[model samples]
Target: MKNKYLTLLFGLLLAASSCNDWLNVDSKTILTDEDISQYPELLETQFLSSYDDLRGCIQAIGDGAFSYRQHHLSSFTDDAANNTPWDAGVMSINISPGRVFASIFSQSKGEILTPVWPYKEINKVNKFILQNKDSENSEVQSLVGEAYFIRAYMYFEMVKRYGGVPLYSGSLDHINSINDRATEEASWDYICNCLDSAIVLLPETQKVATEDRDRANRYTALALKSRAMLYAGTIAKYGKVINNGLQGVRADAARDYLIKAADAASQIIQENKYSLSSEFGDLFNGKDEDNNEIIFRFSNVAKTGRQVFHDYWNMPYRVKKAGYTAFMSPVLDIVEQFEKLDGTIQPLDYSAKFSDPADFFAGRDKRLDATIIYPGGEFMGERYSIYRETRVKTASGTKVYAYSNQEDWTNADKVPGHESYMMSGYDGIFPNTSGGGFTNYGFYLKKTLYAVKQLEDYLSAENEQDAVIIRYGEVILNYAEAAIELATSYGETKYLAEAQTAFDQLRDIHGGLPSKTMTIDVVRHERRIDLLYEGFRYWDLKRWRIGTEMHNKQFDALHPILNIDETQSPTAIYYTIERVSAPDYLITRTKWFQERDYYCPVPTDQSPGITQNDGWN
Candidate 1:
């Protein structure tokens, strides 16, 4: 039976890439164990074929090839807004028949971002682990461990969305049965157990230059376990459960999961492998200047690397450098979360604080500058001046009255009489176009964007930035969060202080901000901003049961409008950050989530008899 299924697994893997580039190079040979052993390199090829399926880091930004491709997960949250109908169904939580499965299909037609059956990868990984568990080869054991890690990672992806998925640990000639849903408890247990097995089998790290460092090691499994357990704990404690036992974790086990989360994090923390750093911004910029900070990065290096079309989608609408549209825009709700330089949580009092709109940037978190591109902000050493050079004809030989109210509109171009700009900003009216300059909200993104010298043509052409899956900053924060939860449950102050120290490390480095008064909420807020676009917000909100409160409510697009019509402002030209109407493309409709909305609707086309999540039925 094992031999028959091994042959099927090999054939399925080869055939899975039938439509892809994998078949173009490899020989179409029916492999027996004998044939594979004779050509040892074929085994390596088989192993590598596993990663090719990932293509790159998971991006639901609609590019595809990432798992489950729920672009709406990020878009629907308050943190981001997409200016296209592609994700409207996602944002509104209103899944119509036409767009019911549109989330996965939104990618290029027939482009499979996630595997048709994740079981295919699971089967391949299972066979590899079975073959390797007894092998004395340390190198081969590491490969085996990675296989375990890969399986765990893949299963967690499904478990996160589908709640619980069918379990498959061994070879199969065919999956003839329904392979019914395991309880959410069983699913998380399976995932964590897989990681534990992986940790025991793998080394601390593999330092050889020839080997890919991106492969899973001891810390990789633990980091994922920590994160996964944290999710389970949050969901069990804060979310709702159903009669089917498919959607929610048991509340009784919630604290235990949280404790396990802290323990998993503590293992990594005690190892002293990595930590937060001053050059934290460099980690996101693709330079990898501070390598120690990243625990396990999704490599997008040379031939093996995955290229993300970031600038193609996220480039500022105003910039004519790239032809791609500004796909996703940041929301005012998230922008306001960045704390003041003094570490105080003061909402940007648009009327009072921004008498001059550009003063909005003053004394803000340094991370705000690192992450967002605001008006009057400079990039690549050049200030973004949207003002054009064209002149208006006048009686005095084109006495060029600056068409912009930017200089004279509010007397913003100076500190009253100084040459420097007091409100170094625009008149708030840039021509809105489909191609680039129109912003749904007033802000632009900078964290995902890495500026290169004019010497390189690749910045606009291709993308290969390292997708940091786990970093030390997150580890510290995770530990901080878990510790805070533990403290809350047990009435301990040490854990609170510990979380405070962890947060203050980041706050101090980014801006010499004050120490945090550690609570789970404060720890989570730090995570929201610190791990901004790395795709954590949606689940975080969902798990906290706040999605219905924060996300289901009507949100505003803050327009920093030039209101010369009003005497309400002392300065006739002072900007008003009005809570203006959301753009038509922005899905501003309030979300309506029933108790069942707590879980994602399973894509029914994948299989028959697969139970629908809570409310979907």
Candidate 2:
């Protein structure tokens, strides 16, 4: 039996590698139904391998150099902006309607920006389910349940991206013969049903010795169901069903889906297995490994070296020695979303001059301090001197010495007084033409960056911080959102009390802010603030039917100017905030998100009967 299992696994893996088309299965290499019936244990090896395939979607990392080394999903959203000019394709396709359709389907650019269809992973999962659905071994049955969860997750990834996609059930032999797209309603239903199966068979908590903790449990399936159902609910309420329900759900079904989302979340909450982490910052910096806040995450055990490259790519230039540093610059638009400690939201007045630019961010939400590196902020035992220009009180009436690049700062003779002042901060808002290693937007991303004391530890792909895929914080927010939508949209007021408790707990525990009355806008603000840069903003905007509205203009950036006057004390030099274009470049293009951009075009080169999504053809 063991030798047979090994042979089947090798043949399946070999066949998977040789086949380019995910749908087409080579009959000679794969396991036959008769072979599976004799050796039911063979499904276990295949089941375990599915987790490896699922990691790509969970980590949000791709095989391409651009995705693995540079681009992040937050950069494609208004939450952050990409500073690297070479990787502008990430932003350009997202912003422009004219280029988006073709760019996503292009073989060269598409793989870098968008996630590839997970039909290959789904195929493996289907085969596992078909053979092991009635296995006599209890463990094999549990593995079959996990297969359902994996299939649901892959379909959710597809449904969210391309609306309705081809849903494959049974083995590869069955899949290869059929080519038809499921309705959007049917796709969402299929995902929810798969989760239902998983919830029934999966254990509440994974056994530490036998099963890996990172693998799916009952609550993990429930958590995903909560998220997926909420997405379907919003699409039904806000989107129009088109092409015979291939793209959207019926409006009347919105309430039922919202209820399912809320119930799934409530079940997890009632179980009381997880809680918010004590320190919000520790969640991402590899400090809170055993914390209850994480429901599901891609674990990065240190010696294995299977870790994320967040610190190497996203850390400010002053901190890291190698790689393209400060790749994502948190724009002012997202920075202002963090409310004050007193629960009053205030926008920064760009027109007003300040004695200190950092003062503009004073007394804001604590999450802001944890999530972004503002000008004059201290990080890794070093202060960020992110100024665009130095204003000196010269004999020639207040000389403004602007630096075009980092090299310009070293020359003292260039300044009027030769005062030996550092022109640009190691962290910067340099001109777009100046080159990489500086932020075009004033702020730097601090969410996923790990603080390394040794400079050598900042090597590419060395940071071992675990990438969080799903956490308790997101589930709490999902519950609050679904309940609030139900109450506000469908007049379902019974869920208000439970929703309010979940909503207030997040803000009070994680954010250290007093809770306000629940509203749709209020829930959304809390969600964005808590989950910033964890890669939820773009999808949230899409599901809410507000992508076109939120991303149709150029984002703003701050330019800090130092007041280096003789009258000012050397230690007490103040800075002023100057509103600048985010890129601050000539021939700047306004980011425009069209309604058609809500669904990415399905590539025409795929299966025969698959109809193209609306506006793509």
Candidate 3:
């Protein structure tokens, strides 16, 4: 087995080094210097390989399953929940140092705890940049620029976790030269510089079907730049409590990073190359391709390409032939965050209008409906019903009412002009009943999900749905955040109104919210509503230095229970909010966020002097 693994790895390296008889390098391996210098065209293939791996290919390489880069983080945070208690269980808090350390080990240790120490991907990117840096060919130079963006992106992912990490942009070698960690500020500066170089060389618009959709273009670099700068600025400004990991940027640096964030986003805004599309549901549902709102996304081909796991994510068990236990249900606590549609600062409660059963989903911010499938809400011609078996005696006859598949009552309780049956006779909680992993918190996520007629291939990663990494909606929020921060702290008069203007774009995209203060909390709130299941909530909480606050609390899950009295003229249905874990099923679940969690433990197997984040061993 060891020999076979070595042989496969050797073949991959050889394929990257030299071309075959057909003058095409093997698709399995990446670009090598010999391949890049001898055949400059191979650089494009190698450069794009970084993206392909991060998108669809990373799933197959790292874990046995096709795990996404961002999916794991979503489970740890309050935004989403994974059913199996591996990491998402409410009981698993204060992660053991042994377990936490196991995940942060360097790549050379024969295991990867996380994507932070990505040596293979970086090696290819550095080789391309170094070999093609002096090339006079326009395309080769452009590839080099893209390589810069990729390296910068790699660094941002690393720095966010490890604070200060080793930097590399040149060719790999006998490595005594580049093992030292730079400060957090230095790493971010390097990321910004890479984007600055990319913006200078890459084209403005993605050429229709070819370069624009799959690869990063000029705007792609800017969009990421805006994203990183905003993060740096927030870390600089608000991250005061956990001070051990960050390498001490000056106070002014926070304002400077915010300025860069606002400016970088402003360039994209001024260019008008992208627009906030109103078709929120259709855009993510795979109905529209290369829409105007998407600044950058992974384009996956149907059967030939690797697939994603959107079908199994937060989908209701009611789907025909359901195998995926709804492990990833959207918790009800976050659902109420949506503002009322009347443009008022009212909590999202539809009980008053519950007289109209259909009104359960109406009148709230439309994004809620687009993202979450609540009990009694309709989607894909199927309504997700979470009601109990209700036995009622109508004036005419005895009947049992279920939200779905209503049945006739039996063993009725004799009454005057009315009849009733025991609720225990029928199956209760149509979809919320936990079986095969289907304990939903009364809601399912519809953001990354698409409705399909047949789901036999659903469990397999056979999905061709594109994984969206960054879009204009986030950039707009970033712009709004930076502007709002600068205006509040520094009293920047010019940005006070500009913040409102930028925020208004998102408002119009998802039916406008009522007038509200453009405070940082409000900006943070808007970000959660728009980017809920996209795996940004966890990072947003961390960057805002509010992880501990969120971790200390438990999320509430609502169960829609319907109770009907046969004696009453009309039946009454009630929705009850309850803890997801039943009285006996509860396993002491909690999220005990500590200061050390701010920075993941540094890989001990790396440099000797590399320190762990403040707390861990």
Candidate 3 local lDDT, residue 511:
52
lDDT of each: 0.60, 0.73, 0.61
* Candidate 1 residue 171 C-alpha distance from true site, Å: 1.5
- RMSD of candidate 3 to the true fold? 6.8
lDDT of 3 by residue, 1-617 (tens): 54554454455567554222211223233545565566554455435657754452222111222343213345556765544344332224334332221132122324333323554556667766766678787877777777777777777777776677777775444342234777788878888898898888777765444547567788889998999999989888877523343543556789989989988888888788888878787667666657888877665457336565554544555553454354565665677777778655454453442433335556788888888777667677875555444545456775654432122212322322334433422222433323333443556667767664445655555446665677888888898899899998977656557667768768867656655668888888888888877767766776777777855556656555444444564555444323354222322124446656667666554345665556666
- Clashing residue pairs in candidate 3 are 90-589, 90-590, 91-589, 103-113, 343-514
Across 1-617, the per-residue lDDT of candidate 2 in tens digits comes to 68978887887768653344545443332555666577766756656777766765453432222125455667666787767665254445654453332221123554554434556567768877876687776777788788898889878877887788777786564454334889999999999999999999888877552233478899999999999999999999999899788898999999999999999999988898889875888888776756788877665536334555555677776777544667677888888888888998888765655665677788888888889999878677777778788777744567777777555643423445645556655566566543356778888888777754445665445556667778899999999999899999889888789879978888988878888998999999899999998877877888899888855577888788876766545633567777767663511224556787788777555465678788878
Q: On lDDT, who's better, 1 or 2?
A: 2
In TM-score terms, candidate 2 sits at 0.89
Q: Rate residue 617 of model 1 by lDDT.
A: 66
* Number of the top-ranking candidate, with TM-score as the measure: 2
Tens digit of lDDT per residue, candidate 1, span 486-604? 67875544455555666778767755577777777788888888888766776677678776665355555665543332223332433445566565544433334444445666656
**lDDT score for candidate 3 against the true structure:** 0.61
For each candidate, give its TM-score against the true structure.
0.80, 0.89, 0.81
Q: Which runs in model 1 stand beyond 4 Å of their true positions?
A: 1-42, 55-63, 67-73, 84-115, 209-213, 301-305, 318-320, 352-357, 385-435, 454-462, 490-498, 561-577, 588-594
Candidate 2 Cα misplacement greater than 4 A, ranges: 1-43, 58-69, 87-92, 98-116, 174-178, 209-213, 301-307, 349-357, 394-396, 409-420, 452-461, 568-572, 584-589
Q: Please give the ranking of all candidate structures by TM-score, highest first, separated by commas.
A: 2, 3, 1
